[model samples]
Target: MLEPEMVAFVERTKSLYPSDRAVSTVVEQRAMYERLAAAFTPPLPDGVRTHDAPFTSPDGHTFMLRLYAPFERERSSGTVLYFHGGGFVVGSLASHDLITARIAADTGLCVIAVDYRLAPEHPAPAAHDDCLAVTRAALDGRLPFGPLPASLQLAGDSAGATLAASVAMRLRDEGVKGVRGLALVYPMLGVEPQSPARETEADAPMLTLADVRRYSALYWGDQAGNEADGADSGMRASVSARVAWTIPLEASRYDGLPPTLAIGVEHDPLRDDARLFAERIRAAGGQAHAPVGKGLVHGSWRALATSPGVQWMHGEVCRFLSDRAAE
Candidate 1:
């Protein structure tokens, strides 16, 4: 059963975006996604300062990097590379500014949120390449931060979490070390259509099976040379071929991944993605814990201000990062 507040929130969302009309075109869909993200994002917290900077990927693709710094009394706790969630098709620094700011304030860490290139226009490998390049730069102390600490962590929500996990896998594959932890919030690991959660939560609020297919198609369709709708073109085949690292859940080896906290919602279609990933990490002899929120739906993080459960989850994430930093 969904919480009353969550149920109301879902109803409001449905009202805002009625299912009667089809959202045509990439522009229309992207606009709807941005509006949804902005609607749920709360005001920026006090004591948190944010500024934008320019970052260039290894492939010469330049993008904006939003830095959220909290006023720490002593020294900074650590640095976190935050990737905003929008299913790789939509999302911006503004969309996730509040969450990033909260992370910085709660963790006392300098948070650099990457505004990676979106897909369908930019396509696959574009977003992943940019994320990987930025992650590499952050790990190498080449980012705006002057000095590095041993407590660097990676974090993201939904599709962003997929990217975070992928980057961790890539870094591990390359023998790059010093990544202390990963914080994944309701991640979408591009699971097969027949997955149990897909069948069980077919009508889950915020994200349904149709929404999943639509978003996946938009990001991985054209790149795979499929003329059909992004969803019609089996995403797994195209996405896996374009960038195998993007599919962290199916990665051949997960032995070297750092301690990870995978948080998911009870009714989310992607809940299995988080749980199975954590299980895989543990099976590989790594530390990975997944906590599923009771009666919550997908994208509950958006209710950070209004939902006590979400607020508590935020604190848990901060605590996880801090504890890993101390290790």
Candidate 2:
């Protein structure tokens, strides 16, 4: 059952980008997604400012990073590296501006949003690689901006949340330090046909199960081998191999990861992903907070202005950042 506000949010969103529309080209999809993003984006919070800078990965691919900071914040408050969600295909830094700005303003922490390369042009591991590079640079104080504070947290939504989780795991494997927390909002951590939400919410508004499969195919491309469609054992093995980084749930272990906040929307097919992830982390003796946004749907973070559930979720995220970053 949808809350009244969430229902309105979904209706307004579909008006801009119809969920039942036939398949379209990537460019067309992006155009529609941008319009949807723009319609929901609120004015930037007072005293929060943003600027963009170019970041070149070790492999020589250049992308942009948008930094949001409060006008009178202490550097000791730490930083958050944010990634935007568009299923690895349709989102940009500009598209997530309002969310990032609000995080910066509310948390009093600088937020850096990565503009990683999209898929179908730079598929699997490309976006992962770019995010990893940015994290590394931030840890080393090598970003164009001034030195990062001692506290650092990695955060993202949807596909971007997948990248953030992957990067956090990779850093743990590398014995790297400085990351203080992990925050994910409606993350698509993995695809399991029998997952509860996948079954009950297959046709979930805003992001359907079909949409999940299609975007994943585009992101994994041919590199996913026979499991590209996620029906074969070959895909599982691939996930165990190079593809694991792009799919955090595929990682063999969940121990030693930072304290985490994984927010799941009740109406999203990906809802169980967040819950399962937190359970695994806790099972491995790590601290994790999994909160389900009742009556909310995927991409509802953009509905902060209209949805009370979104407002509550945003406050939870801000508290997580403030507490964990200070730890």
Candidate 3:
């Protein structure tokens, strides 16, 4: 059951999104997202300490890193290196402000939300490079995650999760294994060119396949020299002999990964994406979280402060993270 707050949350959503229905499009989609984001306000409290600092990428594009830690840091745990999901185009740390703050409070860890360079301006390796760079910096010196657990959990929803995967792969490639865990939320794992399922879910609420197409164009470009294909389309290159940017799919390729938990929403376009990856992790001999968020939707975890579904979903997330920390 949704918390009582969820009722009001749904009502407010109805008022804000007249015909909250997604439509088809390949252009002008970014403007549509900007409109939706402008109207959406997450109701969270104040007094949470946050710092907006700039970090440099290997390619030299500057990223704005927002650190959200508890006001009372005397009792902090570890840290969550998060990437904001906007399909590599639209979102930033500011857009996910309340979500990051709540993660800090809920998971008992400082959440570092990275504002990676977006597409149409900076593409491919630019975004992935920033995520990798920051992860190294946090584990190296800048962040206050003193000798963090052998593994720092990398997390994010949608595009952010994709970046997190990239970071994990890079770390593995460089023979680094400091990541404690990974939490992925309905990650976009492939280059959805003309997949039948993608075409079918073209009108998912809040995020449409059409919107993804436009964002893909902006990120990967037209494919005819516009996109940094290898960097943007992570599926194009294998991170290892078996797994690429994702955990695994062939069931036999899931070795050497740290503990992992993947959360999926029933009413999301990316539902199967999470399920397939978790299955791969389990097949590879790593632990995978239970059934993906039952009866929930994409973006539910981030909606914890306002929506009922979000509270339930995040409760499960907290439980999963707590269990991992205990292990």
Which candidate has the top score in TM-score?
2
The prediction achieving the highest lDDT against the true structure is 2
lDDT of 1 by residue, 285-305 (tens): 999999988778887787777
Q: Runs in model 2 with CA error above 4 Å?
A: 20-22, 73-76, 225-240
Model 2 lDDT-worst window of ten: 222-231
For residues 1-327, could you state the per-residue lDDT of candidate 3 as single tens digits? 334554454455556544433343323444554554555646544546777777776567676887776776546566788888878877767667756777776777767898887776775656777888889877676653334333367888888877786677668667886777887777775555224436555665555676566665666554423334456445333323222332223223556666767676655566666777667777867877735555555555545656656777667656665556556
Better of 1 and 3 by TM-score: 1
TM-score on alpha carbons, each prediction: 0.90, 0.94, 0.77
Worst 10 residues of 1 by lDDT: 224-233
lDDT of 2: 0.88
RMSD of each: 3.7, 2.7, 5.4
For 186-223, candidate 2 gives per-residue lDDT tens digits of: 99897442289999999989988888988888888555
- Which of candidates 1 and 2 is the stronger one according to lDDT? 2
Which scores higher on TM-score, 1 or 2? Answer: 2
